[model samples]
Target: MEYMNIINQIIILFLIIIVGFIAGKNKIISQEANVTLSKILLNITLPFLIISAFNFDFSKNMLKTAVTILIISIFVHGTLSIVSLILYKKQEEGVRKVLRFITIFSNCGFIGYPVAGSIYGSEGIFYAAIYNVGFNIFVWTIGILIFQSGNVKGKGLLRKVFINPGIISVSIGMTLFVFSIKLPYVISETIKLIGNITIPLSMIIVGVSLCGTSLKSAFKEGVYYYASFFRLVLVPLVVYFILTLFKFKGIYLGIPLIVSAMPAAANTVTFAQIYNGDVSCATKITIVSTIFSAITLPLMVLLLK
Candidate 1:
């Protein structure tokens, strides 16, 4: 039953992607417009989404769980970074960079919150939000370095890493969570309403990205299948087993497992465009892994149950 709900949500998201793909194919969303959309998503909607995730009422037990999740999230990302670095070292440089980035970062924000909420409700979102802190931190720091390697040096790279929207929003969200600061009802709702655009908008952008690339070409790259396997199958299985070894079960185990299993971050395409990485490769990996997740996610849920 819960697995059906997960499938339904994914199908809805995929439908939105189809909408964007059709629009892009018809030239409704031009290349220039897609670039602008990416900027809007990264700077505007994503930040609000991050902030709104922290809007729930505070409790000591929740706070404790939040802290635990934060620590685990950081450790998981760090481990994945090392693993990706070692695994993809022999690939071509451009593809290597994007592969490492996508493998290390999943679609935690755009897909994770809703899916987590569906299964665990508000409590699930809280864990997703907390886990995202580590995600934001690593993505800004190490993830940027992956894209910018040898291109931007020293202070330029540092500026990009430290001053991005991801870090800023994480900072704001974490401050609110730690201090238990509540926005007035209207302000919170407004933030959430805007933040809600992120998922659909992200999917549309991904669809737009897929416009020119054929399904054959998209799957032509064998490396994409390798990356998808790492992202959708291996990562979640490793996370689930590791957490269980530590006796972390229920929501703690489930939330991280789901988040880790998510497809390549949609931001892979956005960031590739921003940093002049391999945009086509990014799109292919993201879409392929996402399509494959329809099978893997339900399997993960069944395992969780």
Candidate 2:
């Protein structure tokens, strides 16, 4: 009964995506509009979510565990991304960039947060948020560097990311926490008010973005499917065994496993656009991976539990 309940919860999220898929098929949401929503999520809402995360309670054990897990996972994600790119060396610049993004990035914030929370509750999200801090920074700086190696100026790299509202919000939120600054009851409430819009808005926007894209195009590419296979199954399974070996077990172990297994992020699309990577290919992979994750995620979560 408990296991079936878990599967049912996952189905609810998948159904949300399917609804978006149908809406897109009917021309209810334009790609342009979807992108606009993504910008709002990226620029305004996502940062707020990060800030709220800092305000949550964290034990020393949680902090230490998160730091260790992330350090290992970061290298894994980066290496896989590079390897995937190398495998496709003969492909055009755009297609290579898209695959590289798929390899390196996981949907920790946008998709991972909601699913993790539903499965493991608030504790899961808090740990996932800590993991997000590292992932977001890497995506902005290192990932962008990979994407824009030939075209960008070194002097303005940090500025390009820092000036954005999401990064700024994360900085402010973390700074407040570092100083032991407690947001007054009223003000913290206000930040929470503004921050709450992020998750659903992000999903809806993803739905909107995914509305009209062709899944068939993505399936036609064997390389993209291979990447999905590793992401949705192989990598998480490896992480599971590693966790068991280390004697770090239970919900903490299970949560990060799912977070690790998430599909490619939408931010990858932005990276692809800026760096001359393959936008169509990136979009295709994101669409297909997300769809498959609907099934893969529940199966993994249940087994891990």
Q: Considering every candidate listed, which one attains the maximal lDDT?
A: 1
Q: Write the per-residue lDDT of candidate 1 for residues 193-271, one digit (tens) a residue.
A: 9888877887787778767567778888888999999999999999999999999988789889999999898688878
**Location of the lowest summed lDDT over 10 successive residues in candidate 2:** 56-65
TM-score of each: 0.87, 0.85
Global CA lDDT computed for model 1: 0.82
lDDT of 2 by residue, 2-48 (tens): 77777886777677766766666777877777777777777766676
Q: Which residue runs does candidate 2 get wrong by more than 4 Å?
A: 89-93, 149-151, 160-170, 175-180
Candidate 1 ranges beyond 4 A from true positions = 148-159, 270-276
lDDT of model 1, residue 9:
72
